[model samples]
Target: MKAIVLAACLVCMSNGAEYVVVVSKKSSFGALSVSQIRDVFLQKRRSLGEQKTIPVNVLGHDEVRAAFESRVLGMDRNRLNAYWVKQHFQGVTPPLTQPSFESVKAFVENVEGAIGYLPGSMVDAKVKAVYEF
Candidate 1:
């Protein structure tokens, strides 16, 4: 299952499917470091300064989600599962999930502190992209 998902992500990347991390256009935050972005997604750090940061995840076994996990979070399935389990034990939780890139974009646009990742081509003026990979 992991191999299949990786293959799909590779195919998308080979076809010029660029992915980026995006935030609300109104957000005061600027470009974030990879570690900072990682912390946000992993729920290690909640707020970006004064604003309460809300991390959004791509739903299900999505290729984009897989890429984000591998390339951004640097976690594989087993590690991710264990991480989540530990978080659950600690009474913490993972980020919210969005069904699609469009939904993520819309959610980020409307919510001041929301942040998410999606295909770069789908980004519009409604949100500002902070990182790309």
Candidate 2:
């Protein structure tokens, strides 16, 4: 049990989900404030230009989820889990979750008003990372 625990911890530390806030390279929208970014990620957005904001997530068990919670929302895992539970009961689904970074980038590129984070290595011509956390 201890070994399993230690291994999981190691994996968590080493394989955090890496992602960046993306914008269309053609977009004139300038740098977004932390509060604005948070609002988008938290589904608190009113609009992003003509379209709305789309918040994307990685897998439920991914390290990026925990890292993003802490870095973006200042919430820890247990608290975030509780938050989702409450939101689900309230009929408010959280952000869309992709199984891999590749899917995240693809979603962002194909969808307008859509912004998401994916692994750093998955970046390409389709999107520009405005911020990284």
Candidate 3:
């Protein structure tokens, strides 16, 4: 049983998708550090300099969302959920969520101050990648 579990873990790790943090191509902001991205997503920091920052998440337990949480936020689902719950009491909600990467890309592209992560292969001319993981 332990061996089977380890093998499953290895398979999941091997299949982990590459992701890139992106902003609108028209955004004046350049690349951001992981800390900056984290702060924006957590609602700890609202803007990059004078530009308002809007962070978007892939909704539900999708693999891309899991990867973003692990790589950018450095927190697993349970811990992140707990953090959101705590923040909710303070009137702080999690970032907006989209049902798909394509929608996320569109939202970031069309909405000023928007930011989101997409599978590396999905990035295109409409959005500029700020960070990758």
Scored by lDDT, the top model is 3
Q: Return the TM-score for each candidate structure.
A: 0.85, 0.73, 0.86
CA error at residue 82 for candidate 3, angstroms? 0.3
- Residue 5 of model 1, lDDT score: 100
Candidates, ranked, TM-score = 3, 1, 2
> Which scores better on TM-score, 1 or 3?
3
List ranges where model 1 is wrong by over 4 Å.
1-17
Instruction: Judge candidate 3 at residue 34 and give its lDDT.
Output: 96
Alpha carbon deviation, residue 66, candidate 1 (Å):
0.6
95: Cα error in model 2, Å = 0.7
| lDDT digits (tens) for residues 40-79 of candidate 2 | 7666674766767778877777776677678877888788
Compared with the true structure, what per-residue lDDT tens digits does model 3 show for residues 1-133? 9999999988876565478999999999898999999999999999999999999998889998998899889999999999999999999999999999899999999999999999877878999989988
| Residue 19 displacement (Å), model 2 | 4.2
On TM-score, the leading prediction is 3
Candidate lDDT (C-alpha), each: 0.89, 0.73, 0.92
With a 3 Å backbone cut-off (N, CA, C), the pairs that clash in candidate 3 are none
**Tens digit of per-residue lDDT, candidate 1, span 16-105:** 548889999999889888888999999999998898899999788788888889999999868998999999999999999988888999
Better of 1 and 3 by lDDT: 3
Supply candidate 2's per-residue lDDT for 1: 100
